[model samples]
Target: MMEGTILTGARIFDGERFFDGHALIAENGRVKAIVPEAEVFGASDVTKLDGGILAPGFIDVQVNGGGGRLLNHDPSPETFFVIARAHRKYGTTALLPTLITDTSEVTRLAVEAAIEAAKADEGVLGIHLEGPHLAPARRGAHLAELMRPMDEEDLDLLCRAAGEMPVLHVTVAAEQVTPMQVERLTKAGVIVSLGHTDCTSDEATRLFNAGARGITHLYNAMSALSHRAPGLVGAALDAGDVWGGIIADGHHADPTALRVALRAKRGPGRLFHVTDAMSLVGSEDDSFELNGRVVHREPGEVCSKLVLENGTLAGSDLDMASGVRFGVQKLELSVEESLRMASAYPAAYLGGEKERGFLKLGCLADCVHLSDDLRALRVWMAGRVR
Candidate 1:
């Protein structure tokens, strides 16, 4: 039998709300209960945690790379452990290793890597395929040479990958991928997201109807939400039932526009932040290569948003901790709301509401201990100290 350990006397955020004078009990590497400090039975094994906020560990759905390695450049599941281990220290308990548009061979290797990591319980939830199927008009940093229209073979590959992995998130241009392709991917248990497109509201809506659950980095790559045009961004905002991800970095989106999206977004379809991070996170390196293109930070620039030598915006270098802080300090959101976006919102978005993202009874014992200033002081993932 496994004996339970108690972490007591801290402010606890149970994913949905906050509480004081509460302690968590973990047995067999799973959360057994969250109870009042006094209600916690007399146990010799109780450990007192320093004063701070205890919140559910964050779940990041889009992680391009970390620990000084880009997933696309390295393209291996073993490297995924390096990425996950790096983010784990910063409060992310679960993550998706995203691969940008690449060759068919590279894509296949990534999928295989994800499957192996998932099988090993490496904190990797699945893989995110960000495209070879994207709109050229909104391709952003994805190489145009590698992108093309989807075909029958492409659909089959995606379907098979989904069947093998625990999660397979596909981000595509709504207009580039037909309703049939979206339907097939959705039915195969893939989480289809809209991004890198120029689809109008109507065409985007058809994809939504086809079970597109979310939008990737809203208001950045896709069509803008204009009063007259009401393009992809407009459709995502109007539909309150779909989740949307935004890059909270100042360069990626202005605060005013982010406020509009946050306020306009309705429930079930709430907005969350994604780092779209690159290799610089968890490392001191300032530059990296993506498919033969050199990407790095600009001089005198303090942010982690990277750019190519030719000035195309490459992936971001923001991590989960920086993203959460930006929500409170810059976005003017309450700490509770900010924490929710970092933890509960993404977990709920990924459909892991009760089990993985909360500190309730029977939930996974994954949480972060934040200092008064909200930095990650200590982290608990799956009932073990990280």
Candidate 2:
């Protein structure tokens, strides 16, 4: 019989709201209960935390790399492990190892790596392919030469891969991927998101209707929102069934713009935080190569940015915790909402809400204990402290 371990002393955020004076009980790699702290007469262990917030571990859907490992550099299970382990330190218990625009051979290897990684580690949720099918004009840091329209072979490969993995999120431009392709991918259980496009609002909405449920890194690498045009940005904000991921590091988007998006966004779909993190995170290295270009991290007192040689903003040097902090401190969002954006919103977006993104009874005991300042103090994956 597995004995329950009671985690007490900190306020618990059970995905939706806070529970004061409650204790989280874990047993057999799942949440057993959320009982009152005074009633925590556990059969086995009791770990008392100091002060802070205890919330569900963050689930990042778009992680390019971490811990000096880029998925594109080495699309293997070992690289997945390294990246997962690196972000785990920052309260991310689960994430999709994202691959930037790469060759078809590399993409196949990454899919295989992700499948293998998920079998061994519950933290590896699946894979996100952020395109070889993007528009050149909005191809922020992705290689332009490699970008192309999706072919029949590409569609077949993606549909097959989606069947084998837990999640297969692909970012494609409306200009490159047809609505029929998007519908086919969505039917195959692939989460199709729009990005790196210069599509109009009507074009974006047509794809959204066809089954693209997400907008990648809203307002960046996509068409801008104009009063007359109302581009992809406007389409994302107006659509009630679409979720958008934003890099809240204050570099990819302005604080005011983020704040306005938060309020302007419709329901059934919400904006969530995605680090879009790179290999620089959890590593001492200041620079790394992306598609043969040297990307450097511009360090700052509050935040840092990774940029290419020509100064195009590349992936971010952010972690889940720091993003949550930025939401509360900069965006004026409540701590509960900020934490939900990191944990619940993304999990819901990934369609894994029931098993993840909550501290409810019977949910996976993947959790993070954050200090008052929102730094991760301790983490637990599957009821085991890591």
Candidate 3:
């Protein structure tokens, strides 16, 4: 097989900036270089792209399912293929298959599944355990009955999983999990994220300092900011070293509020986009079960927009491509910034392989080709077109 190809003639976002007329050269599933179009004489094919934007393929750190397959409904290693293929069509070349609050046994199965998928060199970048360790007061769509504080067995399972998975992320509540536990998880190389909390800023900052590197779906299912008590939202915006993920699907957060959060994010770490996507993404079906409860995509809602009967947002019907579009068209984020949130920032947070996120020389050639309106047209992952 010819292992090299040069893709040309699109506006390329190199993570930091955009350049037109750049040729991205890939060989053997890795980037050779991005050179001037004229300089890209190659041993294989040279493909000319239609006018649009070309950016690094999105890396979603919090995806529940894709392609009409819900991970929680089918928590087996083999199911990752269906989910990965589903989300790939929407430009998420890499993702963490998120398992929401479930039993201990199910959690173990999900972790094993992720490890197996990773071993098979599938599109899974990691595993996100969104929790059985969440605060009941804030457990949005999570099964409150299954929720509880983290115990020793839970901690041990997580530690073992971290050792096996390329990346292991767990979402917990600040009040539910002690700072020492958070420290231990971080020490074990797990990306411990605080979520589903009603913690005060003082408690939130303390937890962040103790090793909670991130906050999940910021401003949702967590305490909102108030003058009397700057809550998790305030802490997430102010914590310079902590990353925050936002749904930004109009329902989860308002565009003006999203703009404010983005502006206020003082960072060595900043806010990034996550779909917190459900099974309906990249699929025609809009109804799925979450923990034995039916969650349906609202009528006529193209983004999926899954919600429970009581109108509780279960998970996003959103995909990475559409999330980027929301940022650009709805929130008015610069296309560069939107793309960064969907791709570079999540890769930076995972901190697994440096070659995974950006489209730099020596990096893996995971890329997305988008239409002018910001819809994903084609995706290239692991140097193969998908």
Best by TM-score: 2
Tens digits of per-residue lDDT for model 2, 244-282: 999999889899999999999999899998999999899
For residues 348-382, could you state the per-residue lDDT of candidate 3 as single tens digits?
A: 88884467768887888899999999899999986
Residue 167: error of model 2 in Å?
0.8
For model 2 the TM-score comes to 0.98
The models' CA-based lDDT, in order, is 0.85, 0.92, 0.85
In model 2, pairs of residues that clash are none
Point out the higher-scoring one by TM-score: 1 or 2: 2
* C-alpha lDDT (0 to 100) for residue 4 of candidate 1: 77
Q: lDDT, candidate 2, residue 271?
A: 95
TM-score (C-alpha) between model 1 and the true structure: 0.96
Each model's number of backbone clashes? 0, 0, 0
List runs of model 3 lying over 4 Å from the truth.
1-3, 41-43, 300-302
Q: Which tens-of-lDDT digit does each residue in 1-386 have in candidate 1?
A: 22577788679988778888888888877889888888776765587889988888888889999898888877787788888988887788889989999988898889888988888776898888999888888989998888888889888888998888778998999757899889998998899999999999999999999989899998878888777999988899888779988788777888888987888887767898788888888889888888887898864222556898878888787778778888888888888888888878888888878778788888889888888778887788778887
> Poorest 10 consecutive residues of model 2 by lDDT?
35-44
